[model samples]
Every structure is written in structure tokens, then in C-alpha cells.
Target: MLTLAAGASAPSVATQLVGSGLIGLREGLETGIVVMILVAFLVKSDRRDALKWVWLGVAAAVAMVAIIFVAIHFGTSTVTGLAAELISGLASLVAVVIVTAMILWMRKAAASISGHLRAGLSKALAVGPFAVASMAFFAVGREGVETALLLVGYAENTAGSIWPLVGLLLGIAVAAALTVALYFGAVRINFAAFFRYTGVFLVVVAAGILAYGVRALQIAGWLPGGSNLAFDVSAHFDTSTWYGTVLQGIFNFRPDPTVLQVVAWAVYLVVVLTLFLRPLPAKPGPERAPLPEPSNIPAS
Candidate 1:
């Protein structure tokens, strides 16, 4: 059973895989789409010479993300007990904040992001190859770093298993394939609908992480009410069972949770879900010019 306390058994690979894979797919697709726009713009504009620099930027961003992920994952592994919980709790909270912001910002920015990227790339082309690469680096790097943070947060629930990492890679691979198909016009996706659905899923995941963070903090003595149990179903639920692991792995569900943790989870889920699923206000269209009035003698 995985609890806020240390030395719990790792979750089942299947459970970790699903959670990590979804995160990978969501973040990967966004990053890939951004890269696709930049690449497509370059190709259409006959700036193929700048392609190498874009690739270079992409490579750099990938490397940066890898380094960050490794550092956090390993760095935290070195600590034990309270220190580990504290670090993991803080990371989880940060991940939730960043991910929530990403989902919200993307909902509004999706329409204009392509144009923005193209414009920036155009400006970069005018500047130099280094600028072009830097543009790609920074643009892709933002998403990459966000992905790393999220994975690290999710990894806390994995109990040091590597299967989640494998799932993340698989998701990225699928996203890359999808992006390539999209670029070639071999596939059609209503990106608006796609992100909207995925955004809801991510919000739910973030709520889970938020609750986990709360519990971790409580255990670490950063928060009160560690002993104030909302309920204890551990005996009945049997977290070692497959079903139990699935719930715990994906949602960070505890058979027994502190009152604060349950409160945090419920509030976060309800408030965020409502805000996310609410209908977006219609975008105002460009105003049409008023027609020239009454030209009775104009023909003459």
C-alpha cells in the first residue's frame, strides 16, 4: 500500500503507465505542433537553410529537459523520510500550478499560437541563424521543462519504478508520429476539440497531484492534521490488489486520507473542472465598415 509515509511498495506498472502516458501525450503533442508550425513556415517560405538551426534548437531543448528530469529524480532519491516527502510535496504543488496554467493559457492561445510562432520565426530569420535556433529553443524548452516537472511529480507515486518512464517515451513517440501525419495532411484533427478534451483530463490529474501534495506535506509536518483521518478503508480496499493499485497510482487515492487532503482534492477538482469545462466566450469578429449611404446621384 502506498501511503504518505515512506517505504510503501511501488504501484503496478499498468497504473503508472497510464498516468505518465497521458501526460506525455498531452505535452508532447503541444510541443510537436509548435515545432511543426515552425518547420512548415520555414519550408513554405523557402527558408529551408534555417531548418538545421531549428533542429539544433530542438536537440538542445530535449537535452535540457533530460538533464532537469534526471537531476530532480535522482536528487530526491538521495533523501529519505521527511526530507523526501517535503521535496516531493513541494514539487507536486509546483507541477500542479504550472500544469494548470498551461491548460488555461493554451485554451485561449491555441488560435493565435501558430501565428505567433511563425511571426517570431520570421523575425528570427531576419536576425540570424543563432536567433532562429534560440527562438525554437526557448519556445520548445518551455513545454519541455513543464513536461519534466510534471513527470517528476507523477514519479513520486511510482515508488521508483522505471515503467512510467517507458510509458512517457511511448507517448512521445506516438505524438511525433501524429505530428508528422498532420504535417503531411495525411490526418485531420480538430485541434480545438482535442485540446479541450485533454484539458479536462489534465485538470483531473492535477487535482490528484494536489491532494497527494497535501498529504505529503501533512506527513512531513509542514501541515497540521496528519492524524485526522477522513476515513480508513485500507483494510477493506486492500491497496496491494490490482484494483487498489490502479486507483492509488492514477489518482493518488489513499484508503485513508487526512481531512485536509480530501478537502483539497474535492475543492480543486470542482473549482478547476467548472472553470475548464465552462463554455468559452465567443471571439469577437472584426467590425465591418458601414456601407456608404444613399448614393442616388452617384451613377450619374
Candidate 2:
């Protein structure tokens, strides 16, 4: 999408807008889930005071992302050719690491994430507002940083940075609106199902990012075997064409790839898919023991 949009003869302004909007949808959905979890904890615990902390965390994360963008934009201009390539390549590599960790963690912890968040909230509440804010900051900050890095990588690899960013923003807006609706019971979605499917989709996307990062490193001379073209399909398909543009934007498809790029893409898919497809352990059911009354326990 980014590549096609970045191309000289890709599409009209409206097409770019729609493409970016879809990208935003995916990005926003991911962020929305985290926000939903945070808000749910606040409402469940009756900790309206803690809500500010959540917003603080979100603001801090956004600020950090902006800083990154400014730094990259200015830094790229200051550095010479090789140096600039190295910086961008290294950044992409770092993004791959962050994205990979997030995927694996989510895969392993998806079943119990709610419980973990609840426990963290309990601890945060015990420590007062500052601690609550810090907790929220860290939680959301993790996701924000990952999103920022991924977006940076995407922007660097593809053409037309602003359009992709626009898409991302639109996605976030839609996701946020949907989340708010869900919170108020105005909307209903099978969250478990949604996460499950999206999780799979994310894994595929991460694989493409990993491949892209490796290619960037090759271009920067940080990796070897860049000279050899893995395969050429450009004779049959021009990436600048309408169908090609759509595929390029959504899947990061390139007609020409280096040997290392192909290998990296394949390895990523194999490893991630193997782990993703592994059957999860069955969750234990809730205990049947009688609950203690709220009045019976001493107040903190």
C-alpha cells in the first residue's frame, strides 16, 4: 500500500484516502483493544480518579511517537547516504524485534491477559494515583511505542508517508468510537473471537514487516547477499498497476526480491505459523467455593 501509494502513477487522491483509511482501521483496532481493557478496569474498580492516569499514559505515548517522527525526519536529512541508510535499516530491525516480541507475548498470554490486567490494576490502586498512572502509562506506552516503531518502518519502506499516517489515524478513530460504544453496551462484539482472528492476521503482517526490515538492512550493507535477485515477476505484473497497488499496500508485495529477503520472509512465516498453530492448553474453569460477603472483609 505504502509502496504503491508512493509510486508515481499509482492512484487518485481519493484512492489514497481510502487505502489509508483501511490501514488506520487495522491499527486503530489494535489500540482500541488496549484502551478498552484500561477503561474496563477503571469502571469495574469504581476508580474514577484513576481514569486521568490512563489519559496521561496515552498522552505520554503519543508524545513519544511524535518525538520519534521529528527525530527521524530531521536526522535523515543531516546524515549522508550510507549513514542515513544505516540509521533507517537499524530502526527497521529494532521494529521487527519489538513487533515479534509483542506477537509472541500475545499468543502465549491471550487467555489470561484479563486476569493479569485486573491484578495489575489492584496493585496500582493500592499505591494511589501516581502509581496508578504509572501503571497505565507503562501498559499503554508499550503498545504505543510498538505502534510508533512499526509505523516508522512502514513509512520508511513505502512511498507517501502522510497518506499512510492518515490511514492509521482514521483507523484509530473508528476503533475508538467502536470501543466507546462497546463500553456503554450500545454495541456488542464477540471480543474473544475478534482477538483470535486479528491475532492471526497480525502474525502475518509481522512476518511481512520482518522481511521488509531484512531487505532494508541488506540495502544499508548491514546484511549480505543483496546482489542476487531471488526472483523477478515484474514481467507479468507491474506494481504500479491498480491490482498490484492494492496488493502492494495490503501485503507488502514486491515483484522483485533479494535472496535474503525471500529467505527472511519464508523463515518468519514458518516459525510464526508453527508457534501460532500450536494448540493452546485448556483453561481451568471457575472454582465453585462460596464467596465471602463484602461486609465481612475489613476495609483498606
Candidate 3:
């Protein structure tokens, strides 16, 4: 049983795969849809010549993400003791922030995403091939970086387990297939609902990461009251078992969390999730013109 402290139970391997898979699916789908929209726009516009440039930008983004992932993986491997703990701890916190922002941004911006891409494509086509490639690079690169950051964050806790990596790769593969179908008009998706539900999932996951960050800080001696037990249910939900690991990876469930950690998790979920799920205010309808006043002395 892995432990942060003397008796803390680490998440089981199964939990790692499931959590990473979800992240991969969600992030991959978001990025895929963006590419799908852009490609479709190009095809419909009969600008097939520029397709190579688009791919060029995508290739660049993918290369950059891969490089960063390897760098972090190798870079952290050499660090030992408190230094490792502090860096990983800081990474988890940053992941929480990035995931939260991406969720909220997707929620609000999804509606106009297609339109925005179409506009961007039109602008880029006029500017020349380099601009088209640059746009693709920036758009795809943003999502790629976000995905990589979150993965690095999760990678820290699992320690040498590759299931998370496998799960994510599978998700991206599936996403690519779906994007192709979407672009070819082979499928139709209710994107609004899709994002809304996935946004909810991400929010919950980010909450777990948030709590993980808190615990990591405590472990690194960055937070106070490490020994204070908010509650302990190790006997009830032992992490060595599959069920316990499920809770561990999915919720960052701590049997003996400090009071501050508990409070932070609760507040984040309540406030962030509440705001996220809240129905957007309806757009006011156009006002109808008032009827013209009847003429007093009129047409004979």
C-alpha cells in the first residue's frame, strides 16, 4: 500500500487507468471537434490546397506536446526527497487551475466555436498559407498543452504505472475517429449538451485534483496541521482494495484529511460546480413593433 504518511493508502492501479481515460476522452474530444470544424470549413470552401498547411500546424503542436511530456517525465525522475514532493505538489495545484479554466471556457465558448473557426479560416486564407498554419498551430496547441499539463499532474501520484498513459492514448484514438465521422457528416452531435455534461464531470474531477493539491502541499510542509485528522475511515475503506482505490483516484479521498483541506474541497465544489451548472440566463427576444394608431379621420 502506498502512503504519503505512515498510514495513508495510495490509489490502486485500476483507479489510475479509469481517471486518466476520462481525462483523455474529454480533452481529446474537445480538441478533435475544433479540428473537425476547421477542416470541414476548408473543404466546403473549396480550399483543399491549404489542407497541408493545416496539418503542418497540427504536426507542430503534437511534436511540442510530446517533447514537453518527455521532458517533465525525465526531469522529475532524477529529483529526490522534498524537492520532488514540492514540484509535484505545485504541478497538481496548477493542473487544478488549468482544468477549471478550460471547463469554464468550453462551457461559454462552445456555442460560437464553429463560427469563430470559420471566421478565423476566412481571415487566414486571405493572409496566406503561413497564417493558416499558424492559426491551426495556436488553436490545436492550446488544447494540447492543456491536456499535457493535466496528465503530468496525474502522473506524479501514480509513480511508474503506465495505465494512465495507456488510457489516455486510447481516448485520443477514439476521439480522432469520432472527429472524422463528424467532419464527413456521418454523425451529428448535440454539442451543447455534450459539453455541459462533460463540463460537469471535469468540475468534479478538478475538485478531486484540488484536494490532492491541498494534501500535496501538506506533505511538502507547505500547509499547516498535517497531523490533524478531519476524519478517518481507513478501516471502512482500505485503499489496498479495488473499491478503495476507486474512491482514492476518483475523489482523492483522504481517510484523514486536515480540516483546511476538507474546507477547501467543499468550497471549491460548491462554488465552482454551482456556477458551472447554473443555467445561462435566457437571451431576451426581439421586441415586436407596436401596432400603428388607428387614423381618426381616414380613408373613404
Off by over 4 Å in 3: 1-13, 284-300
lDDT of candidate model 1 versus the reference: 0.80
lDDT of 2 by residue, 82-131 (tens): 78777777776787778668766766665655556667778888888777
Please, what are the lDDT tens digits per residue for candidate 1 over residues 101-166? 878887767766765777788889999999999999999999998889888877787666776787
What tens-digit string does per-residue lDDT give for candidate 3 at 1-300? 022233334456567767878778878878887777677777767888999999999999999988878777766667878777777777778878877887777666665566677788889999999999999998998898888877877666565666678778887887788777766567666666667787787777777777777877787899887778789876787678877778776667768778878888899999998889887655443211111111111111
> Candidate 3 has which clashing residue pairs, if any?
none
Clash count (model 2, backbone only):
6
The 0-to-1 C-alpha lDDT of every candidate, in the order given, reads 0.80, 0.65, 0.74
Ranking by lDDT: 1, 3, 2
* Backbone clash count, each prediction separately: 0, 6, 0
Candidate numbers sorted by TM-score from highest down? 1, 3, 2
RMSD of 2: 5.3
How many angstroms is residue 284 displaced in model 2 relative to the true structure, after the best TM-score fit?
A: 0.6
Best by TM-score: 1
